[model samples]
Target: MALFSARRGSGLAAWLLAGSLACLLLVLVDASRMAEERTRERAHGRALVARVGLTDLALFNEARYTRHLSQADRHAAFQDHPGALEHFPAGSLAGPARPSP
Candidate 1:
């Protein structure tokens, strides 16, 4: 007598498919619930911005040049020397600042 039979109809594949479907359903349900909450949060954020007048979002805390991309100077990253390599990790991730019109 074999401990496990090769012809056994355990339906393991069906069970895995059903489990994945259940998880997907839970994610969709959670997203629907959060949609309403996000709308309210966005409105609150807008009101706060209007009242406090917030500045640009800080992208990286590593260096001053990488902190605010909009206000960052292109040459600020090369403070050490003109041909010096970027010391900050965030500097490589961020592209050059947009030219002012």
Candidate 2:
């Protein structure tokens, strides 16, 4: 059985490689299907954008201040008080608002 045992390891490696290739092929097929769906979605998104008119996309819904950074009032963060700490988790993600010229 020594001769058979020597080939057993190679057999397992070959099966593993074949299984990996099969998985890769499945992923490629799925990606191709998603690509077609993405093209249709892109066209729908363009239509929505045109109908809605140009507006800044809201990134964070956690707080009003973070909802529209470009239009955010710098002093709005201290609406509660002058020394209030940032309570919303999204507040930390945004940097200080730029001062208007």
Candidate 3:
């Protein structure tokens, strides 16, 4: 069996296979960690949306609209039209999620 073992190159192939498996395991662990982080981020986003009482689409639109506007700018935008429907954020008020007839 020594002759066959010598021909097989001293267990290097086995060690290489083990190393490859370890690398794969590390990659999988890293991927799972990234997925967990993304899940937490999504949950936090959902919680904020719920707390503000808005749908995802509405929240996105409002954020985009207000992203460049400062508090004073927003105040000015609304100050001219007090209690106006157009001034109100789409999702801030209670309304149907979908359009109804």
Candidate 4:
């Protein structure tokens, strides 16, 4: 009876140890995968920001060109008819007004 009990106790301890090791390994693998995912997310965020910045630069260039053209047109209009400005409204020289929502 004593021998049987000792053998049973040893078997139980081995089983518990194996289960604990398995759980530890699983946790380690999950943690590693999470770390990799975070790294990928950060890279994607950086790429997105770069793309947005490039788009903003292009828009800024286009706006600058439009502004230059509007200024030129105003100058030409005033030069062509000096008295025409006095007959027009106050905001007439500012180009077409933006439509309200």
Q: Assess each prediction's global lDDT (C-alpha) against the native.
A: 0.71, 0.71, 0.55, 0.54
Backbone clash pairs in model 1 (N, Cα, C under 3 Å; residues 3+ apart or in different chains), count: 0
In candidate 3, stretches whose alpha carbon ends up further than 4 angstroms from where it belongs are 1-10, 44-101
Angstrom error of the Cα, residue 12, model 2: value is 1.0
lDDT of 1 by residue, 5-94 (tens): 334544555566778999999999999789999998889878877898865565587777777665666667766654467888876776
Evaluate model 4: give its TM-score.
0.35
Model 2 per-residue lDDT tens digits across residues 18-85: 78999999999999899999999888878887998735565686677777766677756555654466
**Largest TM-score belongs to which candidate?**
1
Candidate 4 runs further than 4 Å off: 1-7, 44-101
Root-mean-square deviation of Cα positions for candidate 4 versus the true structure, in angstroms: 19.5
For all candidates, what are the clash counts? 0, 0, 0, 0
Q: Of 1 and 3, which scores higher on TM-score?
A: 1
Which residue runs of candidate 1 sit more than 4 Å off their true CA positions?
1-10, 78-84, 98-101
Considering summed lDDT, which 10 consecutive residues are worst modelled in model 1?
Answer: 1-10
What TM-score, computed on C-alpha atoms, does each candidate reach? 0.62, 0.57, 0.34, 0.35
lDDT for model 3 comes to 0.55
Q: Can you write out model 3's per-residue Cα lDDT over 1-101, one digit (the tens) per residue?
A: 45335347656666677789999999998998999999989998799878987543533245443433322234333444544344446424522222237
Candidate 1, after superposition: displacement of residue 4 in Å?
Answer: 19
lDDT of 1: 0.71
